[model samples]
Target chain A: MKLTINRNYLNDAIQQVSKAVSSRPAMPILGGIKIDVTHQVIVLTASDTDISIQSFIPIEQDQMIVATIHEPGNIILPAKVFVEMIKKLPADQVSIEVEDHFRTTIRSGSTEIQMVGFDPEEFPLLPAIDQNEIIQIPGDLLKTMIRQTIFSASTSEQTPVLTGVLWNLKDNVLKFVSTDRHRLASRTAAITAPDQYQFNHIVIAAKTLSELSRLIPDQNTMIDIVVAENQVLFKVDNILFYTRILDGTYPDTSKIIPQTYETEMVIDTKSLLEAIDRAYLMSREEKTNIVRFMTIDEHTVEISSSSTELGKVTEQQKVQSYKGEPLKIAFNSKYMIDVLKVVDSEQIFIGFSGTMRPIIIKPLDHDYNTYIILPYRTVN
Target chain B: MKLTINRNYLNDAIQQVSKAVSSRPAMPILGGIKIDVTHQVIVLTASDTDISIQSFIPIEQDQMIVATIHEPGNIILPAKVFVEMIKKLPADQVSIEVEDHFRTTIRSGSTEIQMVGFDPEEFPLLPAIDQNEIIQIPGDLLKTMIRQTIFSASTSEQTPVLTGVLWNLKDNVLKFVSTDRHRLASRTAAITAPDQYQFNHIVIAAKTLSELSRLIPDQNTMIDIVVAENQVLFKVDNILFYTRILDGTYPDTSKIIPQTYETEMVIDTKSLLEAIDRAYLMSREEKTNIVRFMTIDEHTVEISSSSTELGKVTEQQKVQSYKGEPLKIAFNSKYMIDVLKVVDSEQIFIGFSGTMRPIIIKPLDHDYNTYIILPYRTVN
Candidate 1:
């Protein structure tokens, strides 16, 4: 294949696909990115066993020339070294040519590299999926939903399905849920899709979903998502991300969420996050990174943590309001801090049923973001 | 000890001394910083078995009141935790009170921390040294000299003295030398010291010397260096750093640096460094990360590296002149890049004795910077 392309566009496409290229691949060919130069477009593909990414650069983008194929062919080059060489090449545009014998020549300015390329036939074929059962959603909204709940997914591989995030769709609202048995994070977003398009439940590996979010740049446009029996594909801009769906069904986490609360308090999000961060650092040398919050009066709240071996830290954050009986509870500072960072509200309302109950934290004025954390028992 | 100290000043002092606090300290008390509060100054001291740092924050610094002591006493607080807490304190001035029994209470604004403090008498004291044999040099020049030669020091502790940089002073010239057997780097600087401050040779651990350089702020002031029989002390500004000097005679590296060359070429320092850096990234996957350079013509040079498994890269750099006979040699790209980064001159001249001998690199102007790299044999 022979083609000339803009350095920036080619770099972006290569970077997006390179994320899926593992350092040590089960199949040696998986470490290389397959480059196909067609008459119309140049497609770049990279995959490990878990996920595969393919990005296409069309011939025309915003009136600028994307690529011109002098000869149509294909070649597979080492992803890492090739990308690094191209990035450091001292030229505005790069020309890539593949000989009939599979020798690839990359030239930019006076710098030229001749590398023995692998036959495209050796590269794995793209997974075939019917797009009939597809739904369209705003890229930004999908990215946000993934960020808000993906962190709660279990990283352990014993229950493979738990390592994935569950996506449930009804009407026009999309809910994302993730749980690691100890804690749960759920977020929902309003998406525009056809009335006929519906999905009961789909589980995609949390890592793959997070990688897909990074692939989608900040664009307000909508991307099409298609789910085949055991595969899910997200067509984000010029990139297509495909991941194999988990086989087992996800556990039901609805009952674990609290339905009511005995006490609720509204506190500034930034203040509480900072206090939790400080307490987290203080607990590193202790058995448990524990931080406790106590409501003394109507407007006074005290956050304190202590380690017999590493001393104690007490931080106070003022809250706007607190109701019901005064309560004191201790929980992992890291968990509460991670959830607080994703909540999109200036003030957060924290609910407490009792000292040992799993506390629920949600936005004071919104219902889209919800996080629950199990509290640690304080030894008196 | 009872005192109220400025938070920023306390943070800076804690940060400077915290480097000496090792996570796996040899002794329990060695992990803490001894805080001695006198009527005039608050001295913070932290020490490991190898190096010790003591910084004094006086009652007043540059017209700004730093610390006010109500009761003069001493206590050793955990360096790591204490530093973190001081950085996060909320108030401008923090009140630190030590009870008669030695419990330390640190309060800033509404935040308070009660940490277990050890008796100051248990802290290890730095060895006392007479100031009769002292050498004064520009702080900035000393920092530059350390950066230029420390990289060539042997990192492996098999030969303990090789891990240190040899400091030899005679007359008004101070020389710094470090060698890892394969390559050697030596630099010299001119300074004025007392007639009695004549030193033949002293070796300080490169790691300790580098850390001491960081303590010297950006200033053109003079720094007093006192070399004891088994310790070296650097007194700069209000900070005093004492490190145990390495015993045993340093290997002679002066003979390894050749006096003449077969081929000499002058090239732009930035261009040469960038080309070497990019070439290094490509060759790093191989065994020695070797990059070869050959003078094609009087004004042109070619740099190339090829890995049998990975691809090859060739870059051309324009040089001002190529003296002596045309030559080609290969050396470790990483070492060349590291040495090139320290060159302050715009144009650097490289002198080669032969293809097998070590290649010497110095500024075109020959103003005190020199780097020698041993060549690796190329397999046919």
Candidate 2:
């Protein structure tokens, strides 16, 4: 485009949209980023078949000047090559000039690079989502919700809807649930929305959620979420992340959760994670990742695992609190470790409703996080 | 062996000798590290076919006691497993006890790991090198010299000697030279050895030199270079690095380096490196990394490269000084950039002999570094 911009802002914008640009696109034009330049703002858009992203840059930001527009123009350059050139350019301000035949000249101080630009009309524009309703939420909380529940989604392709995280909103409480038949993870947060605003069982792909999380700011910035008939859009500051919603309805998992538990134990999260990691070595020898934990005495829980070729590993740690009947259970150490890693708390409470039921896990200090994992049957 | 040692010291020693341990050994016993414990010192040794390294831990160092041996014995432990266990041990002092049938028990705090150990007799002992001659040099200097020429060594195994850097010592001067037939890099340094102690044309494998460089201390620690008939040993403090010398004799590259030049240009080494890097893009486009440099005026040189498919790149900068007839030459920018990256001087001198001969590159403020690169033929 016929404009001058700061190198840092432009670099960041290009990288954000590049997440949607595939190296080998079904259409050749999909490999490029559509650059739309105007006197007020410049928009960069890139899309794959499933997800699309658009980033905007204003002339002045935060009371400082970032770029100056000499002439308003638009052109699409090769994304990969343009990114590499912008990264190594040795100037504070970068200028792009498109001449006849769509020939583009990029100048930054003493370094000038000329590239053959493609026709802007061939590039796909941003998809128009029917944004009739929208809900605003904190960026940091949304990111945390995605991180906590997305990992529990199934990676298998047979059930396409299971590969997404389900979003359920009612009475201003937003809850996210993800399950792969064996285990499930759920997180909830309170949002300041209208009393009548409600969205039920909206499934978003795990991959798209992760990409949007990365684009969201780490701090407490406000993000606008717009749910359309077939697509969802997440607007964070000057960036808009859009993804297609899964067609099928998310299955109901509420009946599987238990209201009462046969046994519950509170233990230090750090020590439990470490003990499980140590037992992981033994699980490899056994051919199945089955690590068992049993309550012994009044204050300790014994964690042990065994392998036929390699030896067995056993260790006992003092549990903070234990109630109900003394019980023994076995589960995949990797799944337990992964769930424990995402829960940020000094102590965790694990609930068990007999040996056949799914075990419930929750941070003692945080009510917003909850995880449930099924146990593997072992003949001891 | 039965011993209690500082965890940090033991971990460092294990890592030092593990560099010589091969993932797939010719013999099963060769995969283990030989451990010999005595009241005074503990030794860790590992060897592959091409290189062997031994590290020793003394009873006391810098007025601090490192380890104490309760009983003196010898046993070999699996290198990879032992290293991993040592890294994750949760104790300040680690105790190792070997029992009958070569069963080893390692204890650190409450964590204990049992690993299967090989018999000491099965592990091959270190090869004895005849220490009749020795040369002492600074570890940092040796490391720098190795880095400057090792990159020029041929990666192809067709010519075994070309895969090594030649060491020539005479007239109280030591020079390192390496070439892949297309280009050659040579570095010379003055040593304080006896005049009669002369060694000429000792070629050591580039892979061995690189491994030894990583073990060398970053400071000015003096390293003892002991040359044997077929093996060369580098001794630094408690570590002994031994490597086999290449079998073939290195070819004489001295006659190919031109003595005089028709054109010499003194320019800022940093600026010239940056200019060549920018022109590097053009060479990639042309399918043959051919970038041309020509004197434009009394104090400026124009660097340009073009790709048939992509466009062209051109840049001009003022030279500090020029002493030669106006001429143009083309060469591979990658080779020029590699040589310039290793040179430490602020200003460098580039000399050209006509247009078809090799170009001599040396630092302006120093006389120790010299690199000669052959020019490529380009059609005008």
What CAPRI grade goes to candidate 1?
A: medium
> What digit string (tens of lDDT, one per residue) describes model 1 on residues A61-88?
8888877778888888987688788777
Model 1 Cα shift for residue A82 (angstroms): 1.5
Q: What is the interface RMSD of candidate 2, in Å?
A: 2.7
Clashes of each: 0, 0
- State the C-alpha lDDT per candidate: 0.85, 0.85
lDDT of 1 by residue, B180-263 (tens): 887778889888777845676689899998898888888797899988888888898878899998987897776787788999
Q: Which residue window of length 10 is worst by lDDT in model 1 chain B? A: B192-201
Candidate 2 residue lDDT tens string, A1-380: 58899998888899999999978888766787778889998888888868899999988999988888888888877675576667777788899888998788888877777877779898765568766677889998898899899999999988999999999889899999999888899999999766688989799999889999999988889999888777888999999988999989788999988999999989999888877777776676566888888889769887777665444556676799888988899998878988988898989999999887899999999789889999988788
lDDT of 2 by residue, B159-268 (tens): 99999999988877889999998899998888767548888878999989999999998878899888777788999989999998898878888798788888889988
Error of 2 at B110 (Å): 2.3
User: How does chain A of every candidate compare to the true chain A by TM-score?
Assistant: 0.95, 0.95
Clashing pairs in 2: none
Best by DockQ: 1
Give the lDDT of residue B243 in candidate 1: 93
Indicate which candidate wins on TM-score: 1
Tell me the interface RMSD of every candidate, in Å: 1.9, 2.7
